[model samples]
Target: MEEYEIAIIGGGPAGIMAAIAASQNSSSVVLLEKNSSLGRKFLLTGGGRCNITNQKPIKKLLNIYPQKNFLKHSFFTFTNEMLLSLFQDKGLNFIEEDEGRIFPMSEKSSDVLDILTDYLDDVVITYNFEVSSITDDFIINDKIKADKIILATGGITYPQTGCNIKNYSLTSQPLTDIKYGLVPLITKEDLSDIAGITLYDVVISYKKSKVKGNVLFSHVGLTGPGIINLSNEISQGLDYNLLENDPDFDIEIAIDLCPDFTREDLKEKFTNDFQLKGKTMLKNYLKLFLTNNFIDFFLAQSDLDGEIQLSKINKKSKNRLIENLKRFAFEITDFNRDLSKVTIGGVDLDNINPKTMESTLIPNLYFAGEVLDLHGPTGGYNLKIAFSTGYLAGLSASEK
Candidate 1:
């Protein structure tokens, strides 16, 4: 048996960081990955560019997480700034994009992976080592013995990338009900005509949750950051079984296509345009605000004619148009679990120590990343959580 001070399972972002952190403390660390290579999902982040972290202040950054209170210690211990500084010290420059999203200067997720792997020089990395068991004595697969074990096996999302929830029962701890997070939603209405159109800075509101981001119209429904973030909020308390059994289940959401303007604002603009361009066709005049592809659809939904003169528009039709532009409603029916960016449920947080990332039920056993019921919205928040928790788990394990 190969014995080590620390054995980290699952070579995703969290496991890799755990191995690096443990090795830095002069501990003999071994990283086991099920895949042939490390970071299969990591390489696919940000469309392969890899959004590493956000540059928001620590206080503001913490607000993005649902489990902000539980993550307070780990996030403070290893912040986005600290992570950026570590990469910068290794000669990897970064670029900060909109919404404080930070990416590698090379714009390659492979480059980010290279910088992370460089820190594992002293760590033993075992590829294609799918661990099936972990004994109470801290023996992994009855072959590798370690004083402490850190589980960073991620969640059920992206199962093709080696995320198997069934394979995560190495410990007897209870797992929470799982739900899809940051996934694109399939709407009841077929949006195939506007499939390729993208609405910028659109506001999607479900219940009290309102998220603003770019919304990409898909053949099936809605996607992109706007709808994806809103999907997270809508998926709360919804388990896989409930969703699977209820095909008719749907949630109504209102999308503000013109978030920059209110109903009155749009009405005022329409009134001025109608008076100034009385002879102009409604379809031609609409080109100033909406795309040509969407004008016909909008006119049909409003029960108005595109060929109608602007001055010929009636009050009822004008009001309906303004209302539809301000609040376009849609019913979200389902989301593909395989396409979810993160999973909402995992090893219960109540059984884990927030400060150390150590399991309260089992000694010397720690949990990190998406395995611990922690998740955040897209644009680098989830990756930040993975790295921060992994670093804390490894650091605490090494000290023990």
Candidate 2:
């Protein structure tokens, strides 16, 4: 039987960090991965650039977690700064973006994983060795024995990157309630016609919840960060069904095609324009205020001829146009179908010790990454959780 002080599973960010941390604490560490190379998911993160972490403080970082207590416990020891410093000390320097998102100076996730590999020289790693099962005493490597085990296996997302479906199987730890977060939403419109067109500075709202920012039409649905933030709320049981099925599902999006102008200001401008070219059709008059296609559609909906004089426009028609500008609604039918961007659920947080990430049900057991039901938005927050929790698990395993 081959014996070691620590055994870490899954060589993603968490597993790599655990191996480095555990080995530094005078424990013989072994990291097991099924992929031919380490950090397959890491390479794909942030669209291959890898948003390593956010420049947010510890308190701010804690706010990003869906479950606060879990993050509070795990982050006490290994923090966002500590993780950045660790990488920096290892020669993987990082820079922050406009939104405080941190990325490697090299602009490559591959560089981050390379640094980890260099740091884990003393830690044994077995690639292409998919972990079939785990027991208290050994990892069953040709009947080999391991002293301590750490399961850093990720969740159901990105199955192509070697996600273990059996991660939740045979677990004595309770799973945390998981649901989709930070994904796009599908709408009833045939957005494919305007798929490449982006709507900027628009107010998108449902019920009392609303966000005014940039959004883009996709072939499948609506996207962009604004929509993604809303998608999380919807997937986590926000009643978007009312916006999907109800014929009266009127989601009022104030497309301030000109948000810079108030209604009164717009009305004044229209009055002056009508005075200058009262003979011009309403469509020609409004063409300056809207896209050509939108103006045509608005005119058609208002039951007005494009070439009609502005003097002939009735109060009812003007009010209707104003209403259309202020309250454009789109029916939403479904949520994002991209499974890779979602973490539906994981190990329940109640049964686990947040401080050490240890299972109260089993001795010498630990969990990290998406398996624990902790996730954040599309930022680097999710990966940060994986690193912090893994550090706690490795430290606790070494102590035991």
Candidate 3:
């Protein structure tokens, strides 16, 4: 067997960081990946321009993680400042966006990957080798053995990115369920005919829940940063209600097209437009507020005539219009988990020592990245978690 001081599995951001951190401190490090090349998914992050990390303060960043406790110790070990320095030292500077979202200075994920790969020049890498099993005795053919192992295999999202099934199903310590995020949502409405209709400045909210954000309607369903945040909540509800076959865990999603305007303001605007341009059709008049197709559809659904004169408008029609604008509700019939952003449940956090990311059940075994039960909303939160955890995992493994 080809024995080494460290054996790191997966070549995504977390795996790569583990390899780099471990190799920088000690020699005899081997990074194993099942893909033809490293950073397969990394290349497609942030719409091909990877969002590296958030520029938010450490305290604020902690709030982003659903499992914040899992990150508590790791953050103290390798802070975001450390992460920034690591990249900047390798010539990959980051720039902050509107909401403090940090992206590569070159605005290219490839640059981020190149820097990591370049920094880990001394670490040996084995590509196209799927890890079927891992044991304390030794790793199987494609021979590699080590004093410690770090599993950084990612979650179920973007399965096409060469993420192996075995990563979530390692014979030694398997993971739980995985969910998707940062992907388009499937709505109850038959949006197949109206795909591509983009409604801007809309407020989407889940009734009586803390979930709410901007919503965009698409042919597949609804999508936006807001919907992805709600997926985690909805997935948990489903898991708890699994036994109730007829359980209706449906969520009522509301859309406010003109969130800034009150019902009276909208009514007054409609009345003013009607009296000012009495000859113009209602469809033609409302086109300025929304797209023509959407305005036509809204009017059609309200059973209101567009060409009718201002004098013909009544109280009932005006009330219906205001109601539609203020509260447009859609029943979430079924949720598609295939396109979620992060894997929700994983190798339970309780089983791993948060301080070192080392497995409490199995000594010398560590887990990092999406393989652990930690995820956050889009905005460079997930990547931050990966770096912090992987750094701790690498340091802990190397010390042992």
Candidate 4:
């Protein structure tokens, strides 16, 4: 039987960082991975480019997470700036894209993984070591004994990447109800007519939650950052089993095609355009405000004649057009779980020490990454959480 001072399970970003941190403290560390190699899911982030972290300020960054106060310590401890700086010092160049998203200059997620793994020279990395059991004495699989254990096993999303929640044996700690997070919504409306069209800076709202970003028209429904973010907001407390069993189970969402302008504003614009392009067809006039394909679908949905002249449009038809543009309503029936970016729930936050990432219910047992109930929106927020919490957990575990 082999022994070590620290055993970090699940070699995703969190486990990898935990092993690195523990090894830096001169503690013998072994990183146990279920997969053949490390970072299988990590390479899939940001479409393989890897949006490492957001460059937003701490205050603004904190607002993204649902549990802001709980993450305050970890965010302050290992900030986005610090994460970027760590790579920068190690000769990694990065580029900042839209919405302050930072990506490696090489635009390869493998490069980011390389930097992380390079730091774990002193740590033992055991592949295909799925831990079957963990005793209270801190022994794993009856083979490895450790003073402390860091469960960096990620949430159940990409199971092929080795995220099997069924394999987890920490029944002593309370695991919160899990749901799909940052998943795309499957709309009831068939948007096949304008499937490839993307609306930029559009507003998608459900109840009081309104999200503004790009929305993509898919064959099945709406997608892209705008709808995905709104899905995250409305998906909370949703019963997935109920959603699966009841086909009628769904939530209604409203999309503002022209969010920058109000209905009255759109009416005014239409009035002016009608005066200038009086002889122009209604569909031709709509081209100024919307795409050709979307205009066809919009006109058909509104039961309006696209062949009619702009000047011939009546007050009722014009009002309906403006209203639809301002508030296009649809029903969201289900989520695209296959493309879900993150898992929403994990071990309840109440049972974990936010500052140290240690389990309050179990001594010398720590949790990090998606295994905890912490998650943020798309664009590197979740990755930062993984890295930050992993660092804190490893640092705390290495101490006496």
State which candidate has the highest lDDT.
1
- Segments of candidate 2 deviating more than 4 angstroms: 136-144, 238-324
Supply the TM-score for candidate 3: 0.88
Per-candidate TM vs. native?
0.94, 0.82, 0.88, 0.94
Q: Tell me how many clashing residue pairs each candidate has.
A: 0, 9, 4, 0
Q: How many clashes show up in model 2?
A: 9
lDDT of 2 by residue, 1-400 (tens): 6677777888988888878778878548888888998988878888788898877777887786668776887777887778887779977888888667999988998887787789888888888978776665555555446777778888766778887557676355666454556667777766665675666667666666566667777888788766765666556554322112322223423344566677777677767776787788877777666666456545664566777788787777766666666666667776665544657467877777887777787777777777777888767888888888888888888777
lDDT scores in order: 0.87, 0.72, 0.77, 0.85
| Segments of candidate 3 deviating more than 4 angstroms | 136-142, 171-176, 192-194, 210-213, 240-252, 262-281, 284-293, 331-338
The better-scoring model by lDDT among 2 and 3 is 3
Candidate 1 Cα misplacement greater than 4 A, ranges: 237-248
Error of 4 at 374 (Å): 0.5
Evaluated against the true structure, the overall lDDT of model 2 is: 0.72
Which pairs of residues collide in candidate 4? none
| Model 2 lDDT at residue 103 | 92
- Per-model RMSD to reference: 2.0, 4.7, 3.3, 2.1
Task: Return the TM-score for candidate 1, rounded to 2 decimals.
Answer: 0.94
Off by over 4 Å in 4: 167-169, 240-248
User: Rank order by TM-score, top first?
Assistant: 4, 1, 3, 2
lDDT of 3: 0.77
